[model samples]
Target: MILRQHGPQLLHHIKILKLKKNLDEHLNNLLTSPWVPENTFQFPARGKRNLRFQSQRQTLESLSDSLDIETSSKALSFLKSTLTSEFVVSLCLLANILQSTISVYKILQSPYCDLKSAVEHTEDSVDHFGNIQRTMDVKFSKIFITAKALMSQVCEEIHFPRVAPHQHYRSNYSTKDPESYLRISVAIPIQDDLINQLKCRFSDRKDLLGTLQCFIPASTTETVDAEPLK
Candidate 1:
């Protein structure tokens, strides 16, 4: 004979399991539908890939709707927090940067790629990111516009965060507009960091490639000298 357990804890656990099952079913249905444009119902993939965040940003609106608010209020609230203008703008900017970075990364990862090609591609990507940093205002404005367009589709408007007066240990830049604040606080720093990281990662490789170039026939001149080789 076995003892039967009956308690409020068991009842609550059953309800929680049922809720999770329902949420899973809803997500499966959304992902399985092929009729949706761009299949926007797909959730962000889990990985060490930047594409995950890009997908998350793309499906944010649809994903938010898929959650049953009454049952998943905490999840809904957390998702909604990312829907803010600044967050969206940052997402757009990061997606833009990562798309270019991934393209270069793919080429570098190709089996056929040579040292020269790798250095060239790396430098090109660094240059591209450098340009964004140089013309940050213009580039960030475009990203901001794109963010606004995306938010508009979700019936949301761009709004700046409130600045508290005389906050403790706060480094205020005193920005009066959303664009200025976001550009300074988000876009510029991200772009700068990307550029710095790329340079740091590729600097030694570039030096090595340059030193080895003299051995390559294509890089050699008809009148190659010992000094040039050295």
Candidate 2:
């Protein structure tokens, strides 16, 4: 027999059977004894509770709690999953732009953050937390919103051609006005930060482009341990 033809139905039937078994076990336990303690079968009014019943109750409660926790954890995990690839690429591009606009004075200051750190470095701390603080600085404020909007526009403009002939015809025929394709050209300013990041990341690699990182910061800082003369 062809299992593929009826696999779904067979699997559902198996699940139903398993559910029925669980229900039967639970019902048998409840029906065989009393919902509350039964004094008729017992000598005392409040005799010792059935050990089997106690075990079943505990098992059911624990299983119920476990199922709840599993369901909630899965939902929370799904909700917290990263944004779309397009969105991620857009955000990365935005950071690239803002990094371009940062002043030389800002780079030498405390926290001494760099855009190369975001791209070249593979640490989560730099990506999520450090970049956020660096982006919020005054020097980066001008290009931040513009960069984001530009990225969004670029994503929206790029469209894929229809695969099926019927789909293509239907889409074209249903439209009252002719749809014209817009050419989107992005002139991403190749700033020093971008160059530095590219250079740092691809310097040792052979197959990558290696000419981007040649910009020098306007200022540098050095710490020295001074000796005190008595």
The model with the greatest lDDT is 1
Candidate 2 stretches with Cα past 4 Å from truth are 33-48, 52-230
Span of ten consecutive residues with least summed lDDT in model 2: 177-186
lDDT of 2 by residue, 1-230 (tens): 68998998898787667655665665564455532354322211111223333334433533343334685465445423222223333444445444433433234232755545433442332343345335433433343343334434424222323334465332222322112111011112223344456455545442231323334333433356669978
| Model 1 lDDT per residue over 1-230, tens place | 12245576676677667655655554543454323485222322322223333334444434444435663455567667777766788778876766667667667778899877888898888888887788888888888887777776656778766677766653345788888888887788777888888889889998887787657787453565656555
lDDT (C-alpha) at residue 110 in model 1 = 80
- The TM-score between candidate 2 and the true structure equals 0.20
Winner by TM-score: 1
Q: After TM-score superposition, what is the CA distance of residue 59 in candidate 1 from its true location, in Å?
A: 9.7
State the RMSD for candidate 1.
9.0
Steric collisions counted per model: 0, 2
